[model samples]
Target: MSDQIKVKLPDGSVKEVSKGTTALDIAKGISPRLADAALAAKVAPLPHNGDQPEARLVDLTRPLEEDSELKLLTDRDPEALEVYRHSSAHLLAAAVLDLFPETKLGHGPSTENGFFYDFYRQTPFTPEDLEKIEKRMQELVKEDVPYAREFLPREESLERFKTEGDFMKCHFIEQFTKPDEKISIYKTGKFLDFCRGPHIPSTGKIKAFKLLNIAGAYWLGDEKNPQLQRIYGTSFFSKKDMDEYFAKLEEAKKRDHRVLGKQLDLFSIQELAGPGLIFWHPKGGIIRKEMEDWMREEYLKRGYSLVVTPHVARTDLWKISGHTGYYKQNFFTPMELDDAEYMLKPMNCPGHVLIYRDQLRSYRDLPMRLGEMGTVYRYERSGVMHGLLRVRGFTQDDAHIFCTPSQIEDEISGCIDFAISVLHTYGFNEFKVELSEWDPNDRKSFIGTDEQWNLAQGSLKKVLDARGIPYKSMPGEAAFYGPKIDVKLVDAIGRLWQLSTVQFDFTLPQRFELEYVGEDGKRHQPLMVHRALYGSIERFFGVLIEHYAGAFPVWLSPVQTVLVPIGEKHLEYANKVGDVLKAKGIRVEVDGRNEKMNAKIREHALQKVPFILVVGDKEAEATSVNVRTRGKDKTETVPLDSFVERIEKLIAEKKPTLD
Candidate 1:
């Protein structure tokens, strides 16, 4: 072994340093400012074979043991923020332990937006407890408590946690560590935790942090186990960033779909009916009708045959589709009927597959596109279900395309185009695409021959490349049956929602023995592409609710216009105008109640009606109406025909704004 190791910097510079020199030493050697600003380090070992391994985060104080490519992460690095937040979680746990020594610790980890630490105690943590913990965390930050790391024999570590009655920690230690291996531990102040950490140096590095709230979580997500209090919090490198995050959080609260769903009279989850099952009210149903009608029309224009299938099928069908073996956990419990087991369909793919295999297909019918707005049922845990985002029963705008090998690329490109059109029509102008490929070595997780995976993945890549679309290649995110392309859209609030997918499935066709007669007069398996544009209608509706903040586009609004008569004398004219709109296929409502005109206008404005038409003596006589457009203060009197024409154009063009 050499007495010195080589450290390569990201700028392609290498320096020879003594073996076991820490990253902090290298940072200081580069510049004092760099060293002072550094929060953590990333190191990738340069093996003798000259292949560089994936870089992993590490503490600045940790010694570099091999020739490695090193990058010091500071506040500028997004990766460093995750490490900072994780360290903040440790600080939170330490504060909890300081105030309540009897509380047993569970795992603490960083989430996409923040971090959370779980604790088990006889009493649940209160809001006041969170405030005290925050104060204690601030004190610890001032003290500059180091996040000290150490390792001990697995048996000794387990025994220590067992002695302290930390059953959760003991369970984690046993589950994650081998019997003879050493276990990694971190200590922040007086709190010790079983963790494999690459944390920021100390508590002082967490500049701006806040304890958000506490939520109940069953240990290991099993209802049979004891519940733990999970403390949620967020941390940022600067106070300015933290303030901006809180501001966005407040905006998100106002746009929360659950609250707006009730206020807008859109949709609801009835406690008596179920948790995840959604009931579309009259207003919501109208919007859904518009959505479905648009989709079905597009399907026909795109040369897809609309199809519908049964909601329940024999378990034998699932067995043939490989869902019985691979996806049984997500399946609703099977029911017995006529001495045969039946199960609710968790996906629409198998039904489409059956339809395709029903008749022998020829090469001329190579690309058979079948689309459906099918509802499927799945068993979701109670705690995991959200309003409409995560649900048990939802409708998918699903389609399946069975194409020949020669037509695979064209079919994929068509699907991509269709997906982009869906996004554009839904008022989403920004989107990201990801290509998910299978891990070749993970045979147990992914099915199909290597050739099948390569061909399918290559076709998808070719289509993307031809269209000049950039996509992230995500390994191991592929479905068990095949590789896929996922399209995520950025909402108005800059949040990404997974909206569309184009998946290549080869295993299901083989499992079901689906064959088509090729031009060679021989039977061959057709390539199958599974796609969903909306992903889920219910979830898409939820996203729309938040994205528009309950103010839908003119075309999609349940009631396009509401007429408020100035007085009882004008009630007949209001009805007359509403009748004209209705004849033109416009969804119009006439408020003929004996109420003040301003009060009626206010009520319709609260409902987010696109246009509130006021009919009075002038409007009734001139065949005109005063329009109070949503989101606008001024009222304008326009001829009734002219107003109707403008609204018709807005609805026909699907304008996102009323003006």
Candidate 2:
């Protein structure tokens, strides 16, 4: 029998260690500096399968029970941040218990943005109480309490939680742990809580942290359950990074689409008109028209047929499409007619499927692309709505391609190219692509066969590699039907927004029973490719407003040029100049009000008009006007005819600048 286990390092080296030796001993043997800096350890069992097992972080003191691959974690690693935040959450709980001895603890974990701890108390936590809690947390940090880990039988843990009157923790212990299992618990000073953790060495390691805010969150996120206080906060490795994070957050707030939308007078959501529905004013409508025009032109240029579909479909249709049963939560209440139940369309896919099956198609007409600006309605939770980004009703610039198996690769490639064109045309210079693939280990979560999944994933990877585009592969992120590619655009402040997706489907085609006759005299199922470049028009427009800060390009601006009269007498000349510009198909507005030239200029500039044409005695006599372009104070005087010609060329070329 072997007394030692062979541990493989990531550097292709192996070390024989005693079977019960812990990861901390291995680190110290390697280097004392590493031992001091190590926060956690990751291990992979030997003889790994194609399924990449999720890496788990464990305490450095955890002992190795078998042969495995070891990876020591440090502060620079992203995974270590989770451990740090979890430790911070513990500090928060300890502080809360010290300040309010009657408070009971709920689960606290690390979020993508930060960490939040939930607490159940008879009375709500006031703002002043939060300040005191924060101060108490700082004191605990100064104390440098050690996080002591221990385990107890499941029954004992439940009994302890029950004795302490922690109903939530008792419920969790009963649900998650088996009777015979040992439950892990961590103790810090007077606080004791159940958890599965790999915390930092001590509380002092948490150097930079701040409590953000407190909100009433339902226990377990269920409205029916008693409410609990959720305190959100963020932590970083250093104070400088935390400061920079706050600075960037402030910059992002300045570019918020909701604020910009109001200031720009672009659109609104009227209370009488109902929530989640948009009312685009004249200025917003002009931009929408331009966007739609460009999209339709591209559809025709790319050999896609423009089709219109109904706004509602029969409930039977949704059942056949498999959405009625699985996606009932997102659908609105159905309307029952005399004969059947009609549902508002939550997606445009089923409509396109009906169109494809309208006629018997042959292999020659296999790759049929149907495009539409389909509007859809969905039921979104009230608290989740955030302006246009998370509205309940929006127009989708959607398309579906029905093609043969042999043509799937080309169709996918074409979709990717089209998405790139969308980014380029919309002035988005940076983007990231993510390929979501099925998890083979979790086969029941998916609907397709292993062969079909393999083929579709290979095709997606091949297309991305052919274009030399880098993408992240996210296992288990795919829909139940098939794999997908989500494209996120990098905004002005470097935050990413998911705006485009190209997905493959095997279940829908099968469910719809769609078929096309092949050249071999056999009927075969057609593959389906669903792609939405702008996901939704309202959301895309919101992103655009934030991207450009309401100053649209020449082709998209509602009032491309404004004619300002320096004095009331110059109104005639301004009208003449406006007429000349309008003749060239440029959108121009004349400002003939009796206001100062500087005031008029300032007002137009504030409106973000691309160009301001000032006509005064100097230019009215000579039949010239002074042009004040946006973002610049200098004025260039030119003849009225010459100025009209310049704007005509600029608008015709669809220039993004006024110059």
Give the Cα lDDT of each candidate. Answer: 0.93, 0.88
- The global Cα lDDT (0 to 1) of model 1 is 0.93
> How do the residues 281-320 of candidate 1 rate in per-residue lDDT, one tens digit apiece?
9999999999999999999999999999999999999998
In angstroms, give how far residue 638 of model 2 lies from its true place.
5.0
- lDDT minimum window of 10 residues, candidate 2: 46-55
The segments of candidate 1 whose C-alpha lies over 4 angstroms from its true place after superposition are 1-8, 12-18, 46-52, 465-468
Supply candidate 2's per-residue lDDT for 41: 86
Return the number of clashes found in candidate 1.
0
Per-residue CA lDDT of model 2 for 235-263, tens digit only, reads 88889979988998997787787887888
Give the top-scoring candidate (lDDT).
1
